[model samples]
Target: MSDTLSPKAAKLHNRTLITTYLYEHKEATKQVLERELGISLPTITQNLRNLEAEHIIELGELQDSTGGRKAQSYRFAAKHRVAIGVALRSNSVCLCAVDLYGDTVQERTHAMSYTNTPMYYQRVGTLINEFAATVAKGGSTVLGVAFSVQGIVSADGTSITFGTLMHNTGLTLETISQSVHYPCIMIHDSDASAMAELWFDPTIRDAVCVYLERRPGGAVIVNGKLYQGPNQCNGAIEHMVLVPNGRQCYCGQRGCMDTYCSLETLPEEGESVPGFFSVLEQGEPHHRERMHTWMEFIAQTIVNARSVIAGDVVIGGEAAQYLDDSDIAALKSRVQQLTPFSTDTFSLHKSRCADTNSIVGAALRYIEAYVDSICTDAE
Candidate 1:
């Protein structure tokens, strides 16, 4: 077997290395890239030229030189391609366009009840096409559209296997893709939120995202990657039983963690998550007690989950903004009391991308795919 890569393979590898570096650093000179990436100056120049031709990279103003000639700076054109993310809720839809750097270029939320009819899906697709056209006004390519739904998505990303919140189970991507021009896929909201968390903090290797929205959900990250498991249901923590023969869950289970830890139950009828937390913070005795009881259930759930997968935990979603240091401390104390292992092994924190995480994460799928295609010569 040959020890060295073929010329074509070497070219692809060098281009991947150079592009990856520029994607991270945002800007670099040919000389700087050659030195830092340890590639030949000729190879760097050729790759940069190719990228410029494709509009993936652009030439910038000359750098101020300390000596003779000023080196020309090359900038990664992040907005050359844009990914569309659609977050489908029970009564509204959140749409956002994201660039290569995972920054939102445009975002909007529209009030519309979800119905599993072809007309409804076609309307959603029409809205996405309009959004894509607006994003494309600046000459950016519309990469694809990703739908973040509240359910378990199949590994193929074509259909929702388990959706109850919006009654969208069995919905196929083709239904929406028919009216839209771009490629499309469906993603579970919890997994989508986890992707956003990963983008916000790339250093996280192993962790669990405890999504405390209207319905409790979770995502598991192992070895710095989302673990969908064989059934694509590895992180379905909502159905984890907490109390036997207790309140029934939407999944037809009794005392599942969702029945107890859901933020939906924390707020009173017609009260918002913020309103409930505000009253709790105002020294309301009953509200405070209610929060305490909720925290106990949340801590119990965390400890139970940690017993199987000993990773750091992040509490996120709609209610994440309301959690304070005191709440975290209380949860930690309770977790310590319940945990069989030392709580010091795993740390806990609140979510940084609370509300926008799912939308951003959904769009990231396309962004990541575009990068991989370029790096692997798939394009």
Candidate 2:
């Protein structure tokens, strides 16, 4: 027999290659796919037709051909599937629906406290059902659900190893998954935010994402992936001791970074992050001094972290949106001073997703898995 792939195997391989290419490139013409995939025109046309029939790919605008006939471009129909992301906080739940393209098409906040009671889980399930109904369009399917919680999540996303906010430990995936019909996963809030940053900016292959929200925390990205330590506590930056005998952290640690760098440190009179930043922007001597001191502590933390992890530092969360370029520059300068080895400027970046990073990242988990599953099956 001739050495060739069986008809069925070849078709599946072509479909997988074409879909993966379009997913990465966003859109491509038949000719482009043929050339990039090293597949013949007939095979490309056949696979494209099959994918289009399955509502996976769709024809786009005609591309300008150098010669006679124009070519038709094809793109992945990203909105064909959706994923739900629920950020379970201490007193509120942020539910968001994201499409395959990582767009948050629908979102809403429901007021509820996190608890271990069955009633609470049932309430969350009801809210999820209602929200899914509201957000899912006629042709789109809910692929899965991801939960971003303020706690230490298991490596497999099946349970919460520890949670300080809920004062609970060993919270299993069944608690939330039983309420929703779709497959579910649980992730630490900081890790989700880090994933959001990585998804929004492809250039950031490795970095430490610092979240300065109501409760400060961090996530470490290694080789373009979240690095949960062997114990699943890799990015607990909040508990890092910044001062030898400073303010007390909720974790019962003295002089932790959370006590110094969190949003809680902002003056209460401002009422909100924007208002607090506004006060600092007004050029008041004391307010400016306070901000300067805060930046110093933040810089100190970055220097300390860099010495261990050696990657770019990304500042994110509610407070990140209020920080201007000058503020980042100031923080960078402080870091440069504190660091002894390199005179070069440290690689620092601001978060692109702002307040919605965790929720968006949560949704992306399922979207990413869906795509990976296709590739895996092809293999």
Candidate 3:
């Protein structure tokens, strides 16, 4: 968007824009890209050719012959340029890899021991490399690694200043970035997920989105861009105390929203948020009662944030996987009970991404960085 941007950088930027478009549209012909990107025919063809050479995308079979000629459609070679994304959770680590699109080509998860300054970084470091190596398709180049830990990332992504679960945040960035043999980037899970939402769901563009995830984060998206606060912690809502003198939080706060409603707070062991919701659906009164109380508490916090942020709220997380569309609609009804906003503006629901949502989110962060670097070099 800047004239000062170099030609190469601009091309990379356009490539990114186009890739995002193709990721959204799945398959597009040259004419489709020309219209969608507003680029000349030669430029579109050349970029497509270059991308194809890089194995970023490939031409599909021809569509119906139009008024002129049957044009070949291009689809992402999601297996071509791979990137790994991982979320650092208190109880476990979630890993995923995707293409330019937020489509998870591969994913894996495992329990991680508590984070020590060094051991945690080493463990996460090992996991990232292993995941990338194990699942990547043939001859694909892993562009970079992205992580969406549940804390505030430094402006330069050099360190994470806050994370009870991510104890190695400060050291891990440097170590991982140095040792990964790829471009390493990090972002708060809240904003990372927001980026994933933007790429994965274009209907969210020019729209404000509120994401409620189990990792304890929030984000404000305007016109397809994430609104990170000046401190790069705009969505740092894990510390927001929803109830005074209600419960103790790991962050040394009383009654933080996470303390009350996070899926991690479920009292029973061996119960995931989704699993609990399943039991509730089976007419288990115990799960139903606890879930109702949790939903009410979450609804209250969202009502306040909704009034302040004022957008369509998207309820997503590992908890959302088990919830059907009807369940989300019902949850929306529950949130409306507390909010004065008209039902028309409220769109509360579960993210369909399941556990891979954050993983795809992490991949996008690296993809953006990859595009930026290419564009910068192009210029």
For all candidates in order, the CA lDDT equals: 0.85, 0.83, 0.71
Question: How do the predictions measure up, each by TM-score?
Answer: 0.93, 0.91, 0.77
Q: Over the stretch 1-379, how does candidate 3's per-residue lDDT look in tens digits?
A: 6357778767777777677677657789998998977877887888889888877678888999858788899987766667888776777888877765456777788897656555666777777777777765466678888877777777777887776655554644875555465677887787777787777676774333334455466777776688886778675566678888878887887988878778766536877766766677788877778877877877776776776676677767656665577767777787787776554465565554555666687788766666455434343
In model 1, residue pairs whose N, Cα or C atoms come closer than 3 Å (at least 3 residues apart or on different chains), thus clashing, are: none
lDDT of model 1, residue 8: 71
What lDDT is obtained when candidate 3 is compared to the true structure? Answer: 0.71
Q: Which ranking of candidates, highest TM-score first?
A: 1, 2, 3
In model 3, the Cα lDDT at residue 279 comes to 74
Candidate 1 per-residue C-alpha lDDT over 212-323 given as tens digits, one digit per residue, 9 for 90 to 100: 8779899999988888897789778889999899889998879999999888777788998788888988889988888888888889888888877889999997777888
Reference-based lDDT, residue 350, model 1:
92
* C-alpha RMSD values across all candidates: 2.3, 2.6, 4.9
Winner of 2 and 3 under lDDT: 2
